[model samples]
Target: MLFRQLFDAESSTYTYLIADHTTKAAVLVDPVLEQVERDLKLLKELGLILHYCLETHVHADHVTGTDRLRQATSCSGIVPDRAHVACADRHIKDGETLHLGDITITAIATPGHTDSHMAYLVNDDRVLTGDALFIRGCGRTDFQSGDAGTLYDSVTKHLFTLPDETLVYPAHDYRGHTVSTIGEEKRWNSRFAERDGRGANRLRHRPSFIEFMNHLNLPDPKKIMEAVPANEMCGHLAATA
Candidate 1:
């Protein structure tokens, strides 16, 4: 089991490279468009053939490089069935597993960050927790189909049930922390701590949807409306005329 995690500073997104040492068969998870060149260069240098490009959810931050990577490497793009993206070759549902030589990654539906969010559990130990769970906090449950109460349930019931030592690799982290263990998050995560009434609960005072929308600082996603249709259909822009 060989793995490398890459971070995009601009969007605080994390892209992962996991490979089987014996076969050099690899997969890229949640790749950002800006980093595609670098990612491909590294993969080529390592003598690894990309077998799959997995999207945890339809992103709202940066454009994905799924189509570009597929064009370059002829890799299949994998995404959750609930996501309406245009480039996926395989639309996986919960409990479905993808195999790469000796490695098997199982998908687990974790729908709080988005309606189609998924957490990929590798060998039932390491989890790529998309935007669902972070080191000190969780994703904001105000976007898409997000519901705070539902997020609470997803965290406490689905994710927290993993063993304490299971490593958690989140989709984005601006703080420069690359990875965390379930035990560490369980003990130190402020969001869960607050939920347990052990500390200050800032989320308790959050405004209603209308009021929250009024104060949202985020801009509309770049090419989101366009990306969705193309992504959902798995269509890529042709490189040549």
Candidate 2:
């Protein structure tokens, strides 16, 4: 397998590039519009064919490069089936599989950052957690129809079920840290750490966590007005306007 992790400073977004060793078929996750050229150059230099462009959610922070990527590489644009985006070329549901050569990517609905968010499991080893789970702190659940309780379940129930050694790659990180394992997060996660398996099983502390998140007076994303609507059409704002 071939993998690359790229970062965007304006939005603190992390774009991922993954490819199969045998066929050189590739896919990109959470690409930003500003970094499309860099992503394409890497693809060209590696002699890999772009097969898929995947989105975890319709972002409210920065515009997606999906439109430009599709135009440049002719890759299929995939999003969760429940996403409000009308421009997704492929609508994947939970448990659905996507193939790039022999590599398999499975969609796991992990909403709460947004109603349609999904974290993808790649080849059953690593998981691209998106904004659902981060290195230490999770995404703010104050907007975009976010629910703190659902996010708690997404982590403790769905994501934590993955192998403890599973590598976690998130979509954004304000800190310099780039990667972590499920085991590390389970132990040190700022919000949900220190709970036993049975505690997580009962969501023993989920309500208090949700209540805290609900009461947090966070500010709206800087680009929400522009980014959200543009991203809804795969970042082609004029197409809908």
Query: Which one wins on TM-score?
Result: 2
139-163 in candidate 2: lDDT tens per residue? 8787888889899999889998899
What's the CA error at residue 136 for candidate 1, in Å?
0.6
For each candidate, what TM-score against the reference?
0.84, 0.93
Q: Positional deviation of 160 in candidate 1, in angstroms?
A: 0.5
| Candidate 1 lDDT | 0.79
- What's the distance in Å from true for residue 4, model 2? 0.8
* C-alpha lDDT values of all predictions: 0.79, 0.88
Candidate 2: residue 220 lDDT (0-100): 88
